[model samples]
Target: MNIGIIGAGAIAHFLLEKINRHRHENLRISSVFVRNKEKYRLLESAYGVSLYTDLEKFLDSDIDLVVETANIDAVKTLLPSVLKKKDAVLISVGALADEALLTEISDLAHAYKHNVHLPSGAIGGLDLLQNAHALGTVTSVSLTTRKPARSLIEEDIDEAKTVFEGTAMEAIRQFPKNMNVSIVLSLAGIGIEKTSVRLVADPHIDKNMHHVEVIGDFGEATFSITNNPLPENPKTSYLAAMSILGTLERIGQKIRIGG
Candidate 1:
């Protein structure tokens, strides 16, 4: 597998390390997209892969599978044509909040015989949720994210306050970089509007916590996840990077359990 990565951010860096650990002899990250030339050099040295600042150059390479970490803008640019040639695995799941865009991509993938892969980034239970949705009506889905007040909001001279409390649609509209889990839940169980979302900044909590509750014909399902934050980027969780690794392995396997 000649893999290509679209960003050199924390998740990308961490995933590359794990991929090396997995050590599929033929599977190598052939190319990476980075904006800065210095960053290209730095990442090239670290990962032993060729780096590109240009999107077209990276896309034209021998990459068979591409993992996009650069978010919506990158998805809009890269996915359109990539779906024409090969499949793309997306980390920026929040981009699908736009119904038109999601439909467009979905249509393209179906037409091209390729696919868009969505991983359980920070939280889990998506398999159970989706399957349950088939068996029973998922009447309501709600997500509550609690974290250190400082971690939830911006830093550097900002007063403390709980910023976001609204629907999943609104959260996706407001926070593109964060709130991917909300978008994922919305897609899996229900539409974005009906899926309830709450964002909190509690000064007391030591770790970033995510709580999910689903009410349906079958009954209720509740889950809580305490995620360790990534060292380089506090906004992303360490579990998220691990999830990506697990997802990658699942895709290549013969019989993926509960995919």
Candidate 2:
């Protein structure tokens, strides 16, 4: 599968290295789209892919899939155009918290016969949550995320503190970069407004911790995951980048583990 990446950040760099190491998978990065050509000029020779500043030229490349490792602004601006040409893998799942933008992308994907894949970022038990929701038995879903103070805020704190508590939609609006897992959980089990979220900044822990609880007619399930932040980026979890690679591998699989 030929892939086009939309950013040149830490996740994009990690993905390029992994894909280069696993060239036998037949996954080739055909091109990259970025705003500043000079800033990412080194990636061209390192990854052996063309970089285009123009959206039209980038979309016109020989790419069957587009992986957006960019931020919410890129998703809001560039993703619709990408879906019109090829399928997309969105890493910024928090952007979908906007109901209007979500509907717009959904309509565009439907109109173009394209798939918008959202990777389960930084957490697990999504398959169970989805299955429970499929049976229409899921009553409530809640997520509590705890991260190091540096990841959550610029100020150094001596003690752990609860930063924010609200619905998934509100959480996303407040902490756009850190609350993507809450949005992903909300999408898998319930609507954003119906899903509750809590964010905490802890000085005691160095890892990013997520606690998910789901209740339903079937039973109650609670999941706790502690993830190390990416080496280059503190706001992103290493597991989240691995999940993107997993999602990409699943694309060409003959039999998918989870539908």
Candidate 3:
């Protein structure tokens, strides 16, 4: 598979290194698309991949898949065009919080015969939630996220604080970067309006923590995960980047394991 990347950030760097280390015969990173060619020229030389500021040229390259590790703004502006040309692996799951945007992307994907893959990201238990949802048995899903104060706010804090509590829709609107996990959980179990979320900033903890709870006819289930931050970026979880690799591997498999 020829892969194109849409960002020149930390996740993009991580993907390039890991893919080179693994040397997957089936996967080759062909190109990258970014706004500032001059700023990101080093990435091109480092990875030996073509970098294009022109979206047209980038899309015209020998790429079968495009991995978008960019933000929600990039997803809104670039994804429809990408899906028209190639299948995409989207890491900015929070963009789907916009109902109109989700509908538009879904329609585009259906019309173009392209698939938009969403990774499980920082949290798990999605398979169980999806299964229960398929049976119409999942009644409630809630996520509580605890992160270091630096990740959530600019100022130093002496103690833990509940920053926000609301439905997934509201949470995503408030903390777009930090609450993408809630959006993923909402999509798997219930609609965003029904899925609850709580955000906490803790000065004492080092890891990004997530607590997920589900209730339904299948019974109650809870998941707790403590994720180390990526060394290059404290705002992102290491597992979130790893999950993209897992998604890429799964894409090549004939026998799929889970939802």
Among these predictions, the greatest lDDT belongs to: 2
Q: Any runs in candidate 3 off by more than 4 Å, and if so which?
A: 154-156
lDDT of 3 at 191: 90
lDDT for 181 in candidate 3 is: 95
lDDT per residue (tens digit) for residues 33-131 in model 1? 877868458677677788887777787888888888887887776788778877788888888888888999989999989978888888988887898
Better of 1 and 2 by lDDT: 2
Put the candidates in lDDT order, highest first. Answer: 2, 3, 1
Where does model 1 exceed 4 Å of error?
A: 21-26, 154-162
User: Candidate 1's C-alpha lDDT?
Assistant: 0.81
Worst 10 residues of 2 by lDDT: 20-29
Q: What TM-score does prediction 2 earn?
A: 0.96
Superposed Cα deviation of residue 133, candidate 3 (Å): 1.1
Error of 2 at 121 (Å): 0.9
